[model samples]
Target chain A: MKQSALLDHPFGARYAAALPAADAARQDARETLALEGLPGPKREEWRFTPLRGLAKIPFIPAASADDIDVCDLPADVPRFTDAHRIVLVNGVYRADLSDTASETGLTVTEAKTPDHGVDAPLAVLNAAYMSGGVTISVRGVVAKPVHLVSIGAAGAEPAAFHPRLAIAVAPAAKLTILETHHGLPGQPYFSNPVTTISVGTAGVLRRYVLVREDSEAFHLATTVADVAADAKFDAFHLGLGGALVRQEISVDFVGEGAAVRLNGAYALMGRAHHDFTTFMNHDMPNCTSSQVFKGVVDGESRGVYQGRVLVARHAQKTDGQQLHKALFLSRGPQIDCKPELEIYADDVKCAHGATTGELDPDHLFYLAARGIDPQAARLLLVQGFLADALENVDDAVVRDILSGEISGWLMRKASA
Target chain B: MALLEIKNLHVSVGGKKILNGISLALNAGEVHAIMGPNGTGKSTLSNVIAGRDGYDVTEGQVLLDGQDILAMEADERARAGVFLAFQYPVEIPGVTTSAFLKTAINAKRRAEGKPEIDAMEFLKLVKAKQKLLSMPDDMIKRALNVGFSGGEKKRAEVLQMTLLEPRVAILDETDSGLDIDALKIVSEGVNTLRGPDRTFLIITHYQRLLNYIVPDHVHVLVGGRVVASGGKELAEQLEAEGYARYLSAA
Candidate 1:
């Protein structure tokens, strides 16, 4: 995957000088990408889902694609009428299509450079070309959720966009954020985004993310969240589409008594490849973190779940658990699951499990005995299998939306 | 014509003969109870009739209104008005009981050229059936049979039977894991479904459930064959003497 096939976007010479806040960090990230290009298959982390297809693409820095005009939010955006909306196209915030009514206890400002420890290649790539991101700071409990919709589109030529977002919740604050990553149906587009979240003392942050890129799109997103003492952070990531999509998340518990629940589900068909790589760093004692991820693959697609829970030497009484289960809808598909637990503390408790299999014949027979035809029975069972992991989603509306998306996928699969 | 007929039905599971030449004729409006001892192929008869997989009908004929039901798929037989309330209903996680009920009911309804049941109509029908089975309203809201007590599973089975109202209902050990109250409630639900157009084959080891639903005819099954057949008094006779007489005859 790392063969100098795809040329680098000039962040130092072309874009970094104009971008505010993280100019130096952007240069550093570009250097990191230059030093460590997209990790090859030899790297154990990238062994499951290689970036050969990504490397073959002639992706120009999305910033250079000035002709890529995003006039409106894509039609596939899940409509939640209650939540306030914030729209971003090609990494730039579009105020005209956004709704910020009665958004008290919330302040949305210009993009600020993200300083989340030194370099992951994609994180640095996001910083190098980062533009059109928002800094959302919350002081008090927000009544309604703030919906962030990031749209990606390329014109005649293949393009890419790097969107940055920094979210901070003050002490004793409560907030819910729903992000829908969508793309227009045209030329192939690459969306590389970095999102950083900071939760304060005793604060609660519930975030749900949906990545539904177009079939011809590439999306590599990195999300970093720091949870303070007595704080609770719950996130559910849903990866539905994209040519080459990777959602890498790092959740660090900075203070004792913090809790983090990261759960996600993905359904892929055709030749799509999706990778969900998560790192739960327990730097403080008495922190509990759990992750449950499930996926369904069909039509020669591949899926990978790489979950690593790192418990530091001083982080005693830390409880970390992760489980990944995948269902194969067809014989052509492949799934790779790696659950790594690096526990350096003796008093720490950790567990990990991974299972990959097809639908149970007994379950199918039970459904068939109830008069559900095999096709319909399969749809119901597949929906149910993913629904088990979707139970982690607490929000009713988002859960319904995710369910509808799955149904949509199923119907499409059936028709295909 | 009999509503259902099993003619010389011989079934084998994995090369071993389970049901050997068990023939029975169930007329419309008749409630026939099959009382048998352990290892007597009680469930094999029901599964073979209902068209379950794995059990090979080496030589047999399971007829629904004189049409060969063994030739049809399990779901096809179901759409043909054959229902088997499983002895041990499966626990299917994530598929809600309400949804399962609606799908099964609608599948039959669709076969009859009826539209899919609307939400309100479905809710009303389910609510009424739940009330009939004395099942709690929220019972259907949970996953099908998952985390349910033994009584709840059997009651759910009866609830499904009441909803589907098949022309031929086979209650296969429906009273196996029931306590006194669940047995009464489940028997009452089955009793309510009994009618002139419907025929029932109640499979049970004990004669207790026959007291609740009062079969018109009782057949003694032992060693994979119907050793004897008679009126309701035969069930009483078996209860008194146990199946030792029938067990020896085979």
Candidate 2:
């Protein structure tokens, strides 16, 4: 595809033409794509991020199908025991590869129309050509976790994959979902995915996303949540991989008495980069939202966090808090954090803070004096820095897995 | 044999002379009290002996059992069985007291080619030491010196010294922020650790602590050097007459 053809509009013709016909939400997707042009380093959000490499890639529709071998998952791998397992292979849903349906409270089908409103080009791209997006509906309270694994298969040729997912929590329902991403080695691909979540009245939904992809991969994902009255949404994100990764989370309190807690930890090393941008909109009264993001960057890595809490005029009694802290290990690494609170309501308590610093030298000295090697001292301090975020995870099993992954990543990076 | 010997030590901080040509020798099983007024570099002497950074040792040599200790780093000095009970203990948050002490003890052990103690064994050691000091069990689990009272912090210093079992223990004003009861408890803990193979150097301004932990030798430090060295009677004389006459003569 010619560069001009891709630049003619926000949603390139190649992207629109490559979208499958089965995706019925293409119109809303296209409108969302009209929001912005291709991002460059000049853009404020893309300042520290190097977009030149992305701009150089030719725009082409991902090939229809390719042969991809599936690796055997570990025996102790986390799986949603009660809910149905949905597997998306190379941005296309493969029903034959997933487990059979088992429960009545959970149902997975293709989205007929996008219910959650999103006005971003990335969202449009995900909605437009989304190959096998999953639409999950939980009717009532459910006692199991839903495991959604996105597996990116290495094709004979390089391509881009966009996956879309929608989750709806019915009234008085409770559900926990673990969404994970797995990519094949030597597969140089871009994953632009979007997930929409709706929490009904008196419902509770806990979502966790664990992203560990090939080091050369590009991941751009956005999660949009719409909460109802007296609903609770607990979301945790763990970012440990990817050459360049950006996850944007936007939440809207459309009903009164809704509460949301957003906690995340990102541990990056080498030349890897990660960005977390969040926006919480309060449109009703008596709502609360809290967000905390902690990151550890070593080597030449970089981390970025931008969070904003918006309180509408009529949304009185809104309580919101946002905190972002990062530890930069090496002098070459950097962290950029911007936390904003925009409140139009008169009676509201909103606070935000951002801090970036190196590891405590005294603490390191003390640890080293205790006979721990310098590298082990660093690992302990990093673990301490990320302890608060990990504490927010309710499941012990999941917390252990996450902690092991972080420690393993650190060890690997140190060894390299 | 001398356990710790400081030969003509001259030290300065921020270009100001603190310890000028001060010399002291501490033999095993000896408890030597070095009494001086404020600004006389008593704390500086202890810090210099402990190898704390930011202090310039212009001309001096600290020998721990005849080894050049002034060239060692603070941790190296610590591993070499030199412990300094600070006048003001630093508060380290997020690190438990028991954890810190265990790490220190293990470090010392590793330096001596000894195997590390198991968790249960270490816990037993902590229990014994806590009981000896009459400290609450919760103090061990709390963050190191964080939110600890003055006396509690002093007791913690003593507890750490007992656990580490250093060859030369330098108590830098351990009695400064302690009550009569706490002082007695701390002195008892120190007294229990006293042996022919260990040396104690207690830095203080008052002789009250000496009443509990009797010093075998007393040194009156004036103008950063020992101006008067005598038996334990020196402490009583200074307690009764004060250092006013000595300061004027020096």
Candidate 3:
């Protein structure tokens, strides 16, 4: 409800001079950001979660922040020994710490600075301060997954950075992309990343993202995927930790018979807040899209899930379904779930559902009666509650690691 | 010494009296059957003994190994060697049956200061006991009782009983959903666990189960009170003659 200046974070001519993309068209992005500030409480999309905390912080551009040491990956990162990894720190590529040379069907290069083309408020901000990212092109079937690790660390002052990723999969190609976003402890760092993906006809793209930022960090990520005819885009988004984090995904069914499965799960505690907003545009006929998101909130935390599916009039036979369920660990936490379906096609089958409830006492009692104590019983149930969504991750190794991470979060909550 | 003793137990559910001044004692290794017509607090007594919630003991005490179990949580009582085979075994999805059984076994071990069961040994034991119950080899791989048939649910309950090896086991209408074949396999499973260190309280509405795992003593409860107490013969008598006489007598 507080009205503040749109340029509260201070991005002026001096700020643009320090950016990595010197040749990028900066005037349009700056003007766009100047026109549209951070989303406020009045906007329905930002109603439940307030960005007042972000507006209050004096976040300098990450390009201007001291060169954070990029010697090692975060200790919490799951080292997938089988996958080829690409490392980035403070939005800039870190070739010194990368293992991408052995990868096949992957060519990593610098991405063009993003354009502010009638995008959302956060996307505009990402454009205005875009720093550095890579473009990955895939052809044929990739034997190993391509892992993208983005690390953020602030020095001396609070900092913010926007990393842009562009991906293209050739026709009949198959690839898996694993992304992890982590930051060092201390400092309220802000990370905004925009990812654009294009899956050619009959191509297959499997994406798995694990976001674990600092307890005081802010992460606003937007991902746009364009699926061609008969292409399959399967993705799982896992939100583990952050002070203010929102992972928004938009899928455009650009070709007929395309299929998309977007599933995610979040486990949050303390004052941490997370939101998963998805928009699936069914522009072509006979396409299918499904979204399943589950979360657990504790310690006065807040969780949100907003899903919208739009089916055009000509997009007949569009099968779209979405469900969001949140489990509250304590009375102090809050959950806001909104599921919207706008279907213009009469032959489409679209269903959206949202459920927010505390742990089922019956389930808890059943576990307890089997000799598991209340705490462990609750933990087991929470794991089970999020299992269906976690099952979306097709890779066995990644699935196990994510499940382990969730268990660790639950243990921390128990001890806290 | 009695392994379990229910002394003048008066239980109420949701402020309504279900059990009125019930008294019973079972020494270790004894199998006692509590039977009656429907709505006679047969299941209520079993639930109260297992430390289930929603049932308030308005009076009296239920003790296990001389320790007052009514004051303990359901899980505490379970770790202290109390088991309840729910009439309707809950279908817990995502937590596999093997995982639940392992946790239960580990819980008992932890309470007794014993090392946790080795995973291989645990699997071998489950396989052997599951064979006794005629359960499928992959039954343990499925989520705990989820999507299982009526008979499979009852069999899974008996499987948990076989694994936990509690000191005092309460089978609350375990025969309710089972067919005659499942009943035989489940009863055979229970009969194998009969030993000097363990005891059983089988609560049922029918005496058909008593034919398989014969009880040492049978008590006929009516109107929340034990109206008749006899040996296994009482079960047969009750089966032959309906509880009409006892219902009116109470």
Candidate 4:
């Protein structure tokens, strides 16, 4: 193994001593993290989103902070009807707070040590010091959806935790999962979570993620999915709160005739910063992928979206599309959007679009003419703008929940 | 006193005069029509009364029920019982017509210190009104005015006027793009709302609409001023002569 030059980095010797002794896999990942420190503004992929704020904080491991204890889920977390609830506090699964009933053809277990390497800086950090996670295996069509709620809190000092999650769906099986990431308001806490998903041939998986961490928290999540022949992967991500948050998702088609739909929406205010980075790799023939992301920025907040779609030489009959749109509520906010398509195959269909604009005065005046107040009119227009993206969510129940969350955010903004 | 009185209304758009010394009084239980050529400030008159921005009111006072409405914002004026039926209703995507209607109704109700309309009650009310306007039941399910035909948009305006029951309703070219059947239906909807407490100010460049909903009074607007005022015959005379005499006189 090559020696790491970044010994003084945050994820280096400073916090590495607090974690348990690492095995070979963790050691290899630690070496990788040391070699390539946290992404900075110099990096092309992370130019818009600088991690210097996160790097400046002196964060100790959450496991070493014994003073923090969360015995109950936050009241703000929605109670999904007829869904299995799994709770995670500071990255460790809490059985006492979970109400997961064992269903047929589905099994859940504690995730093992990291054995696979994901080529991302954050994933490398997560592999180095992952505290705890869950491995969910689906063997047949599951009747009820699974809800995984991750909560973060720091007591007496800024803390950080890395969690690893793995999901596998057998051939011809189907499942749906909803993940909600939340945190309490206190000393800043950082959550670094890595999720690996695999869908067998002809299987289906629907994943919905909602990240609404506390305003003083930082969350960086990495999700990589491998899809096989004729499988379908549908996912929607909704970001509402966090001081600084980045959700990076990448999908690779390993077999022919697979399809993927990755869509997301975000609302930011105050000094919050949110970034969404997506990569779609079509290495097989007859594969399709589409992405649609929208955001609303207010106050002095910032929003960024970077999408990269790649079609290999042999990947004929590939179809890929991406679009990003943002609305600004005030002059103090900033938005950055970049879409890159690298297509090497001639027989492929690819397109991308990005737009940034303020609310239309005509629409506002029209609503105002109907006796709707100015604030109420703006809320309606913003919701209408986001509705275009939210409509992509296939499930009506989940769509309603996400819409309610957006309304709540808007109400808070109005009051603030 | 007239229900809606406009006194010496002088309006300008972008520092250029549009309506110069325009005066009219619409009495209670009366329907008044203002007919003029295309550039005669008919739409400006309606827009100024509706409190749209960007129109500098150099010297004017629009009184609704004896309260000056020019000092109010567009939405405040709307809640104060002023409605303007747009010629081109805005197409707002993702906002269902049902939601917008409920919100508008609730805003008016709240202003009047009344409880908001419940879902069932609102549904019943809107369904009845929609039927009267000959609108399909699923029209409310779509986005507000999005993908709606011209006739549908006009009918929707009538539906809103009926639901709000404003004291003074100004229709800006309501007959512009309507077919004969749509015109009859829209006129019928407006005629049903005519009563002792309601007043109508119908602004149009054509007299064909007056044939269906005959006005109690007609005024000929030429060169930003009302050069002539008479009872229903003026609309017919202007239509027959095509405003040529009045345009030359102004």
Cα-based TM-score, every candidate? 0.96, 0.85, 0.96, 0.95
TM-score of 3: 0.96
What shift in Å separates residue A61 of candidate 2 from its native position after superposition? 6.6
Q: Clashing pairs in model 4?
A: none
Model 3 CA deviation exceeding 4 Å by range: A1-7, A12-14, A20-24, A115-118
Instruction: For candidate 3, write residues A94-203 as lDDT tens digits.
Output: 88878886556778897656753537678777777778898889989988888889998887788888888888999899989889888998778899998889999999
DockQ of each: 0.69, 0.25, 0.69, 0.77
lDDT per residue, candidate 1, A226-271, as tens digits? 9999999999999988998999999989999999999999999999
The better-scoring model by lDDT among 1 and 4 is: 4
Q: Which pairs clash (backbone N, Cα, C closer than 3 Å) in model 3?
A: none
Higher-ranked by DockQ: 2 or 4: 4
lDDT (10s digit) by residue, model 2, range A1-416: 22332323223665566545534466656654544455555555556666556555644445453455554443334454554567776666667767745677888886445555566546766765565577889988776677787876556655677777888999899988888786777656778788889999999999988888778878889889999999999999999888889888999898999999999999898888999989999999999999989988888888989898999999999999999988888888878888888889999999998888887766665554444445656766676667547778887656666777776677777787
Ranking by lDDT: 4, 3, 1, 2
Q: In angstroms, how far off is B45's CA in candidate 2?
A: 3.0
Best by lDDT: 4
Per DockQ, the best of the predicted structures is 4
